[model samples]
Target: MNFLSQDKSSSRPNKAIIILSLWVFAILLLGFTFRTSLDEMITVWINVEEYSHGFFIPVITVYFLWLRRHELKFIEEFKHSLPGLVIVFIGLILLILGGLATLKTVEQYAFIITLTGMFTIAFGLPGLRVGAIPLLFLIFMVPFPQFILNNLSSKLQLISSWLGVEFIRACNIMVYLEGNVIDLGIYKLQVVDACSGLRYLFPLASLSFLCAYLFKGPFWQKVLIFFSSAPLTIFMNSLRIGIIGIMVDNWGTEMAEGFLHDFEGWIIFLICMGLLFIEMWLFSRLSGRKVAFNELVLIPTEWSGDTKQGNPDIRFNKSVFLLMLLLIGAAIASHNIEGRKDLIPSRKAFLNFPLQLGKWEGRNDYLNQYYLDVLKLTDYVIINYTQPESGNHINFYSAYYQSQREGVSVHSPKSCIPGDGWQITQFGQRDFPDFKVDGNALIINRAIIQKGDSKQLVYYWFQQRGRTITNEYLVKWYLFYDSITMNRTDGSLIRLITSVKAGENIEAADQRLQAFIKDLIPVLPAYLPGKNS
Candidate 1:
């Protein structure tokens, strides 16, 4: 009775429980209402990693509680905090505003809001403070905004490409480098942003967050481990690519092409993970602290001293289990939606080339090519032209010429006119070197051609979407160019010339355009650029 009286657990109202409930409800609502583009981007990852690493979150959560068990044992009994609810409300408002403003901004703020809300709820709760780890876990399930991901991925691309080039060149492999592309004589390997090992980021981040919570390492050391993942992942992936290049050089394409490709990625991942474990072990040893493995057991009966509150609520445990089940379901549902393949249009429906043109090809110089195989071509159209003059005026001419050859104009199709059935979803100046359009300038025009298996691709033309021509290097370039792509009946893309430059008169533009068109006329070889099939 004396010991129980000494404990402040009974004095505090169970406000923390109410606060936590509200927090959980809010997050559940957010997860429900918010369908995100980032979520879609990670679909492939979810599919591949779900079975393999799906247990990681729970395993880590349990480990964290174990490590903090000693401290958590004394946590006051659950209590509601009305003030905490106000804090959560404020955070909710900010989070909603952020989501509305921009998905990227919202993603950046998401974790912050989560942390604040969780801490606010856990503040007054003694025994319930352990819930923070689980609350924090929700952030991992949220999709990251595209802007942040794109920028991070781009940086990874540069780092991985640079390291890969250096490593491959060291092997005396006759390779030419251009940005992320490696010209390995016969085959060009563009270290696509995905291959930059950016995929490992979320997993590593998850691990780091868990480590930070579970370990008693120096604050700087924890931060260091988290940030080091970027370079560590990039370097390891580069090494993997380098090894693959060497193997391909010695063994030929067959060994490097199929099974080995996947095998190599896994090998690199394991190696990196092994390195992470070693680093953690070394850090713990150096800090004179033992690793915590069995820290989460329930209090001993001797130490329990009648602190048991009416037999651990079966409902509480059941709620946690049910919540976990629901999370798993939610994750699965999100993945299902994300991975759903687009229904292919019927060939006849797609190929009904209407004389009443809703969308039709305008005059263009370069030939458009469509294909089903992703690796057969660059899946992009190239425009080649030169400017004779200098200054903004010359740049304008290059742009105008390219623009004339790139896209269809809004003018009525002479073949047949549609009463506003066709609306160009996107049309504007392109920002590629020779593909910009400015004030009055010399331009070029040539015949536009469209061919695909189903023919819907000929109508659903692609644009750059959005870009501005403020680049200084582009301003100096003699040629302006860019690419346009349309969706194929299949999931592949049908590439068309989005932009091209022609600084010369119409006659010269016509000559070059004809030559370009003839080179790709009737049929293009499979090896040419923009030929995916």
Candidate 2:
């Protein structure tokens, strides 16, 4: 009997080794296959401040898994699952589509799904149930797509600016709020993207998730702890802005720059963490339980109680083997498909675009080098056209990209205008029955934006592959659709802006843009690539 027990104990290590080996092989294979996606995620982690916390997510996930190792090992049996293979197949399909579209966001999500499928296949359902939270936590590593980030940042900037101004006003300081700029008598504070609270929000939210998971509390309390991060971050960020404003007012403008500014941001983030802890403590008190702070906040040492000691039965899952074969086949097919480049139609460069359109004469303008780098446009044109008779000048801007597969696509003016201190007060689509391009009526987004007392009439549309899209969501949909159907993701944004002068009716501004659009319609195909071109 002693000899039999010794033999069983010896087999346990062998089982562990086999399981570890399979996991390592699967992970290494996934890493090799999704190398580009991983590189892109790492690039964002290193460069983008808001998502820098992504660097620690993988380590945290592994730590969580390690903590649950005992529980996973005690499972009664490991069985091959058909459902796991089905999930793996779906993940491979997503990988193939994401690869063909060159969408890093899609590919990154697919990588997570594929990893989950592998885990489910290797560990079986019971093991997965034990480690589910850690697997789900991996999602925090992926940075949001640029469009969503832009919109969120813009909204946060506006909210922080408003709250900061109100706080200053309560302190008896004379302050004026215009969009995202706080105008204080001698100095102005612009709530740029960095101050939008996202830098604090993402990391703090991740921390809150960790805190919620570890907090030994009721379900409702855990949820409350997780949801509180947003408001806490926003409030703390606004408080920081108000403090900066007060310091600048008393100590001069130097208080708002360099080390002091960044130090304040760090301080605010720390305060947010403290607030979350305070929330957890409050919940503990309300629940009629006195839990120690260390117990509530520390990493869990154990996931589950130990089970009977025995050598659990284990077998190689043929379904997982078949799934691996399918993955290998899909990887080869994706590599070949991605290697083929899309067809780029020839078109006239923006430089050769006509400077004179009917009665209007134009002078070209150039964007700053920093702006050009940020935009990453393949080609662009910016011109101020004036009707010499009416002295009505309109700014015409167009940005063209040869391909948008790599995520550098057109940014909507709706997302960008507020960043420059302009607030969009009115927005809707306008149809020009008289204006025709290739026998189709013109439709464009018309927005009335204001800054201080100044107003401007803006018209913009996305021209892509013979489609004129006024809606931003439709543009995104078409980008995905065209990437799959036509193997083309080339597009351009055309914007026309005219100021509403003092005491001048907005109708005049509208008419001015309409007239310019009429003149600009026929000539756009020369520069913007379309089906006819």
Candidate 3:
């Protein structure tokens, strides 16, 4: 008698359960496969203020998917894309290569790529087309490499200091800018790492992406809104710095201390969010539309409902099954290979390095334990040499690594010097007129760094596998290359620094470093290996 009123859920075969089960299985496999990278990413999210937003990325991603759940309701049958197999395979290769290289950054990226491939595999191109934005939004969760972050922070500090100084001048307040330091007549304010705007940049950029997704606007307008977060953050942070400087100048040093400093940051961040909305309002008028302020960030018309719809039913196929096998196999294999050690190249230890080269008297120098832990170097040598004839002295230092597979690596002077209260005055590559390495003119990074009226000339480069490189970016590249081709990631950073006396010109300082290089290179190869070694 109740045949006409049968249960609809039972009739439909509970496709959602099947779909979720497949997702759970796949996600568990992914977790196991990338546990090392994922654990590190979580640690960064907890520890690094700049990337704290990473903890919320996945929750937001799931919310986005929930918003588009209506679209999934209408898909007649989930399709497995045969072509996605290639992408999944490629992701595995990247994982293997990254794991072997011990590049956690690369391994983290590979996790995203693998998930992308899995998405493509599970639902095919049509599903991919629908879910692309939510998937790609996960990118904000990954943190940049430490060196890159330091370099970026250093650059932003200088920019902010310059802008803050300009604001002081605009206010009829006198100020002198030295590197990242703003010298107010009464007080000196240094634009250190904390003031670099990175804390605002990452979070605001992530917020902009979410806002852009929900924004009802033209395609170009959405892109503009997203990319503008970086500049907007920089401008607002500079404004905050300038305001603090002016306040300190007029009021007192108390204006820049305690809860007031933190309050200023919060106010600046709120203003940044408000400015984004204002930008949308202005953009609407320019486009000849009167968009309501509240409506500016409303979900687009397209997301309201789906058209050309069909019923969704889970369908398992060969491609998806093969993907499961690959995931399981790779995860188990990686677990076994996780403990394998790096192949360190043979070389003389730095402890045995000669203190005296030629015509130069030397004194051995050592870094404190705190620096030694932070740097995580395998071996190093630090010496100060003086030529008695000219009373000239040079500071020579080199840090070596047996296996720079993960976080341990060289620290570039370009980034580290700024943190040590030294501001870079000049930075560029220079070739020696009298020195050569492997038949080519030796090139090094030349920089004039100053702190509080004291000036120093510095020369530095990276010696890796067999090549000498001046650029920090290239050092990372060759590190990966040699890791793959030569099974070696060993390298050393060579640096020579000399002071510029009150009456001495920079040329004299440069000559002192160059002469030291000539005497140093011949002795370096014994400690730092050549290409063949």
Candidate 4:
């Protein structure tokens, strides 16, 4: 009777393991086969922010799982709730729809479906075992929807701008504040989105989760730690902006440019971590818990085996485990490769002008001048100077409505690296130069510039297909340009242009255009590179 009881109990555990494995397998199969929008969505976050820098995220994940290993090992075979399975299936469907919608180029609406599914799956199940698995998926929060992201980004900009203004003012720097911009008599600085607190969201979220899981306190304490990230991130990011602002005010913008700028980022992050630790220590004292910093009490229970000694690994089931690991690795690699392929441009051809001879090869001078004119009309602007480093191609015609109100003045979307939005749209034609310049007379593509009472449409192109012509040699070229239509409920355009080059140019293109523009719109400032000037 005793032996039979023991055998029955042991069989139960094995059955539970089989069931759990099946569920995990099912989730994986569904996740891979149905396609969750996670790949593309998460890719955007990883591209925009350097969140995956180093092995920080991986290390954190490993540590977190290791810390919970003992507790996780004894996790009961979760009750087989058919209702929960139904809910998970619904979530799976939503995830599939989101992915399909994304593939169809309908991104805005996909998020709703994905979020609904995630929320349903998390809510439908009960108990720690149930919610824990779904909640672990919250790492997807990094890729916020565009609308939400924009709103959050603007909030971050406002915080950074406010701090920058205060710091500059405290330093007795002569400055005029409008929105998120500062006119320091010499240079105008706009506290744009990138500099905003938005950068810390993913890191803070990850850290908060780790702290929550590790802390041996009430559930509310964990919740509090997770929620504290908002204020913590905002406060630290403000400090970063203020420090940078002070540097800019005292030692010119050059002091805050280049790789040194990134160095400041790390310093700020370290300081933020210090603050977090201090706060945690304070909390522990108040709560009267002698919580150890690295304390993780791992214990075995009913489902756990004796860790004091391994049972010779039961003769080592190596082949099956190796194959399973290999499969997981291959899935991850395939996803990453596919993601990279999706990002690269499908076509590589120069744009040819209809009326003019020779294609508008991507010439630097031409591309710069082309985009400069188009952007002038928009109230708020986002520019991409590089392709590989930068992730998206976007020029906001009315972005000013957000940042300008937030007290940011000098706005620039360009950062350190070159990526997307660098190449100009070629329309239907092909062939662009490596670089081209504009003379006094700026040539505008008539087809692109549309005039309307309430709205306007402006299209332009930029390409870099030519080599250095300074040494007296014709340059090779290709054609690329961006086209955009502007809608203005409010009257008045931001920039008034004179002319744009239709094709190839001789002599100094920029000088000629600059002279013309200076004569034409005296109020407009001379073209200055955001990072340089």
Cα RMSD, model 2: 2.6
The alpha-carbon deviation from the true structure for residue 408 of candidate 1, after best TM-score superposition, in angstroms, is 23
- What are the per-residue Cα lDDT tens digits for candidate 4 across 198-293? 667667667666665555567887788777877888877777777777787778897567987878877777776666666676677678877665
Compared with the true structure, what per-residue lDDT tens digits does model 3 show for residues 425-530? 8889987756766555678999999998899999999888778899888999888887777878889899999999998999988877877888887888789887
- Predict model 4's lDDT versus the native: 0.41
lDDT measured at residue 400 in model 3 versus the true structure, 0 to 100: 96
Clashes of 2: 0
Q: Could you tell me every candidate's TM-score relative to the true structure? A: 0.50, 0.93, 0.90, 0.49
Name the TM-score of candidate 4: 0.49
lDDT of 2 by residue, 349-440 (tens): 99998889989899999999987887788999999999888889899999998898765888888888986568999999988889865567
CA RMSD of each candidate after superposition: 14.5, 2.6, 3.2, 15.9
lDDT of 1 at 505: 40
Tens-place lDDT per residue, model 1, 416-518, is 1111112122222222233322211112221232221111101111211122222222311211222213221122122222222334343443343333333
